[model samples]
Target: MFPTFPHRKWYEQRIDTMEELEQHVLNAHFPEDAYFRGMPSADFICISSFYRQYLQDNKDSLNWSEQQVGIGVTMSLPEVGKQQYKESSFEILDYFYKCLRELGSKELSFNSIAYLAQHYGLPTNLIDFSADPKISLFFACFDEKEWFTDKDCTLYVSDILWHVKAMMPSNQTIPMGYFKHPTENRGMTEAEADEMMFNMFTTIDKDSSETVTPKIELDEVKYSARIHNQKGVFVYHCDDVPFDRIMHTSNCNDGFNKVFVINKELKPKILEKLNNEYKINEKFVYPDVEEDPNLDLILAAAEKTKQKFDLP
Candidate 1:
């Protein structure tokens, strides 16, 4: 029913209970570098809002010939050159960085700025994921807006090593040894792993190609309270294609993609278990920050109360 390879495969299953979900994840036996993302709707593909909007904004180009369309199906930017594509992506990003600069957050790398923009609700070619599978499930189960309450959700389990291999350009050889897997005799430090991944994703040189690569993780140089609380890491879309499309079309024999479609009726149960049993409620995922006026006032009041109680 699904594509398979000797060492990797693409598979999906309907998950009903927490135990079943855990067992399914355990069966996969993902490497330590695996990352997970949960979406409110199972139908949702792993595409960033920016690219999604870009496609929508230029719907007519969808019919253009490959040469005319240039980048790919989803990317319809004028085929003047790579500069045009870079500018289109960077326009809003530069504006975001400028705003942050005005607010005194200086010296932020481009990826750091882009991460912040995504967190603050600005669209970019980045998708959020968690190191913890259950946390991703928490996001899948809980939707405050009730927009997708009746919809089945999806939990994505991605193996970074294979994902990168699948996304690499046909002519380029992936440096598998650069990142030492947890199972390897010699393991790379967390910082080293992050730096290696960050460099791989961000560096643009003569060797880079238009072919979509597996989404690479970003280094969280900027401190985001919500991101930190959520164990948030990001996968950068290096090309114009949507993430799931790349995964499905990847030719790598060892590339693996697994998604668990959560039952709609069981969402509440899952959410309750996550919140009460696992203690992963909204507050736990989004810690209070000074930028929130309401939280700031609440914290000030609590501090005053503590001071009053301490009076001798």
Candidate 2:
């Protein structure tokens, strides 16, 4: 569905040093804000950091790449294959919200349920981004051990609401795309209605005329206290999108955005600057970083260790 053909070279810029990386990523200014304000898109522009510049469409899902090799699940299935990907997502969301409602948040909507799932680490295709460049870089530099090579990381800038929808799938050939759900006087196509049916979840962007409230724009939703603090938003992804695909294919004029391969050695320096200068340590990123969530994480690890050794 990336039908836009600008006929140009791939939009990737490699930053060889931390000094330059910082200026472009952390310190750069948007000269194009006036243009951005006029677009029909929601300002879903955000950054994501990956340890490796080449990792694309690396999503957490029912079938993550780590488990795919042995399972023989390929992305090449027919329409049913498409439906399976879409349906499983809906099923997991429904199950999670059902359990929550039983526990008493009676008014959860589908969008809220998806947000909860992603933040709590349940498998879904949503990827995280932040309006703040530093927040995105923090993730890139997180867990020094997970930081590979000379401390190299990549920063991605994307307008997810634009690219993901324009590139959304219409059939098995494409396999990954968004379903058009109308909120106005217009009637739902049978397929669109199905997408909204039982799960009732939608990231609906309404037209100016629609009387029904638009589905929540994920970019605007404060899904949780932790995400709210991190300045995070979820970029909905379909199974077939490679992490790198957005770089070369998005049709928007301003979409070339920025690309950088940060110096590996700079990881520690940046991490230190962030935690000490901006106070972006465990407490900020993890929310009460030293409290319940982190302790729970440590406890879970301890239980796993004890189980492995058959310790009493």
Candidate 3:
């Protein structure tokens, strides 16, 4: 089914049957650097749950900022938009790392914490993809609950690494302010804040000839049981824009990124084949393991982390 709502669809091809969907995957040539993502619906834009939630939460504030200010009406919230959110994301991430550290994860990197948080059902800026297209197919056919056949699902294919390397803007300097300590008593003076912000964000020009890349492909090191089982990889815009938005605005031509829209009617058939034939079901994709001991502590840490951020 074609989506009734307005959404960005790229090089979208309709797959009418299970055989056709398999044939497309079989016949198509995926580059060595390619990554695949699947969604339960065609209309879903490629964005992280955290970013999506943030946008939804501040929809009114965002709209207010976009409109012209009128007499006697004040802008109640600080201007909230994509850029500001991106800046705030860094601080939030630092808090997650600190939280994990507090829970005895001293050696874990920020990226590792991000992967763990995502797998554990926490909202994060990381978007999951798989190196194997078959895994993507399983996800497209089955939502976590059950077979999602109400509408057409999508399997998005792209060499995102290639796209970023070839098309992403380079050498852009951005202000990423410092995260305040929990026990900090005094507020930073204007000059101190400016200097700290400048130093933190200005490290990019380390080499005059080198340029910074905007997209981060998280390392392939297995961070969690589920992540390893799923052959999971993650991609995120360093600037915090949706990956689709970055691809849309780039100068590159089509075919680099493709979307296969599986027929809604064929979802059940596809899922069955995936399970019985390919052995790519939930049991296979999600490995059974004892729950993380710090699950509650981590959750509380996340709440504490968010509370520390003074986002408007």
Instruction: Write the residue-wise lDDT of candidate 3 on 1-312 in tens digits.
Output: 111212235467889975687678855677786779888877775767676657667665554322222223222222446556665555666677777778765466445666666665556666778888888878887876654558798888876554334321231233222323212433655445544443333222212111122222244243355676677767644433346644444434656667788888887787787788778888777655453334465566667665675332
- lDDT per residue as tens, model 2, 132-211: 76777777666535525444565666554443233323322433323343333336553564454322323522111111
Candidate 3 regions with alpha-carbon error over 4 angstroms = 1-10, 64-83, 146-148, 167-220, 238-241, 249-254, 290-312
* Estimated TM-score for each candidate: 0.67, 0.58, 0.67
| lDDT at residue 168 of model 3 (Cα atoms) | 16
Q: What stretches of model 2 exceed 4 Å from their correct place?
A: 1-9, 31-80, 144-151, 164-223, 252-255, 289-312
Order of the predicted models by lDDT, top scorer first: 3, 1, 2
Candidate 3 contains a number of clashing pairs equal to 0
Could you tell which candidate, 1 or 2, scores higher by TM-score? 1
Let me know the TM-score candidate 3 reaches against the reference structure: 0.67
Cα shift from native, residue 16, model 3 (Å) = 0.8
RMSD of each: 11.2, 11.3, 11.2
Number of backbone collisions per candidate: 2, 10, 0
Model 3 lDDT on a 0 to 1 scale: 0.59
Ranking according to TM-score, highest score first: 1, 3, 2
Clashing pairs in 1: 167-213, 167-214
The collision pairs in model 2 are 56-243, 57-242, 57-243, 150-264, 150-265, 151-264, 152-264, 168-177, 169-176, 169-177
Q: What C-alpha lDDT, on a 0 to 100 scale, does residue 281 get in candidate 1?
A: 86
How accurate locally is residue 209 in candidate 3, as Cα lDDT from 0 to 100?
Answer: 14
